[model samples]
Target chain A: MGNQKLYKGSLQTIILKLLAQNDKMYGYEITQHVKELTKGELKITEGALYPALHKLEAEGLLDVEVAKVGNRLRKYYKLTENGTKETANKLAEMQEFLKTMQHLVNPKFSLE
Target chain B: MELTKEQVLQIDNYISACGIKYYDVKMEIVDHFASILELRLEEEPDLDFKKAIVEEHKKFSNNGFKKLLEIKTDSVHKRFFKSSLKHLFSFFTLPKVIITIAIFLGLQFIMNSISDTEIFFNILQGFALLLSFRLLFNVNMRNNNKISFLSLSITLRFFNVFHLFTILFQFLDNINGEGFNNIHLLAYMVLFLFYWSGEYVYYQNKKEVQEQYPNVIV
Candidate 1:
């Protein structure tokens, strides 16, 4: 389900895919969602996740909304137009790579 | 039922250490954590609120908040740059520029008329402009971005006028072969350049300090 070398490189694609499916999420919620969906196969640390989120926001790929929920202000992130288009491209690329990996791992499987 | 005053203060200190610039955001996070502790106490009546809060905090690791603080710095840097542009714009204008030209022309006239006073006054004028530039850069160092446009213009105009007057005096002194020598003029230029270089080095060090100890408090 996960590879250590691929983790850092594909983190943004993984985030974009999750956000595309879920629409919007806060920082902690994104980490929790990834953990659950991967069945604990991938654990994204808060340290790694936040800097990426901030960089994406600065680059205009993400938009943030601060909502007052109870006594707390929860910062929610949603995909911007650029982010949405980026997600489609990244997902296609990931799928192609996965297919290539499968062929290399079992070349004997004669599947046309 | 409620957090004690000491507990609230401790939480506030912890949040402040995280280096968040927005006080309201920090307060909200502290309040959220306190509420969570209060809820935990409700389920386990005898549970120590402070201990429970600490335990819950440990779940997310100390570095989590620090990383979030770093993320916030990008926005703060943008605001800082915008303010600097505003300050720079306020310094340039018409009246100020005109006044500088007038000073230059006026000094030329004065040096032509009173050759006796030309050398002394010109040296003084240039020194004063260099001094004023240093003072303005010092103010920038202290982060006073709200520079008044009108005041800065007036000050800069006065400096330009003085500098021109000094040059006129020096030229007259040179042509007449009296009052001051070439060495004196060279000395002033050297001093101005040295002062300017010193200011550049000071600001470069300031940037380094900012990078090492980033604006994010945590």
Candidate 2:
């Protein structure tokens, strides 16, 4: 479980990773998915989720599709081709950060 | 726990009252509210719908929906600028670059060959005015049809139309009675190409939106 400060920086990476797995997701689905995955440890507030989504879309890393779902229009986001490549890069970066954190926190851990 | 039609309308009213005016933004927020409300009702059957709505909305932080609107608008502007730049640069790419050069050379030749510079300028001015009016007419038609959701691309097209008009007036004022030198010819050629590129981008964007949202009466 990560704190808000840690989670804030990786929110975009987490979203890109999730969208890489899922074909498409709407706003609420994303929040609930994160909460469920973390077993209630991580709660993605709507305030954070939407702005991140919008930013990704703006950056051409995500594409938007609006569908009429049960009377209301739901905006579903999926990764673009560039986003797919970006997901791999972001995941690698996150892995490196985690390894560094482990080396710092656990003195016995070796880089090898 | 499916939401009733009345409940959906209430959610729409809530979003509208919260100042989420853009149709696209409103739709997204309404959908978010709907899902949250349904989950709330499912968890606590006795919770009142209105109360649940308020509770769910409170999760949007202290600024409520205002922050969402700002973020959405900012995102749209960024996307619009990026897409426009891409389109503008496409003229310098392979295949398109050939056509761009051809147009440039063709315009330069015509401008140099024409002895009556005023006639050529008048023709250019007329074309600019015609394009401005056509864009204004298209925007008005969309507005009258109640399709007021000006997406980023559409908004850019509107801006370009007005911008072309301003450039036309400026060109007329600045170039009047001045001999058409090589630099002036090159500038006019660039302006013409830019205007064409803008129209091409606008047409492509409009076609895309029309295809994406077939139900949108645009």
Q: Write the per-residue lDDT of candidate 1 for residues B80-160, one digit (tens) a residue.
A: 344334533443467655664565556456555765654555655556565655555654433344321222222233334
**Tens digit per residue, CA lDDT, model 2, B97-175:** 7887787778677877889876776676666677667666765545565644546435554556565554766666466
Measured with C-alpha atoms, the lDDT of residue A92 in candidate 1 is 91
Residue-level lDDT for B107 in candidate 2: 69
Q: List runs of model 1 lying over 4 Å from the truth.
A: A1-6, A108-112, B1-12, B18-49, B52-218
> Chain A vs. true chain A, TM-score per candidate?
0.87, 0.94
Estimate, for each residue in A45-70, the C-alpha lDDT of model 2 and write its tens digit.
88888988988988989998888787
C-alpha TM-scores of all predictions: 0.50, 0.79
Please report the candidate that would top TM-score against the real structure. 2
C-alpha positional error of residue A83 in candidate 2 after TM-score superposition, expressed in Å? 2.7
Highest DockQ model number: 2
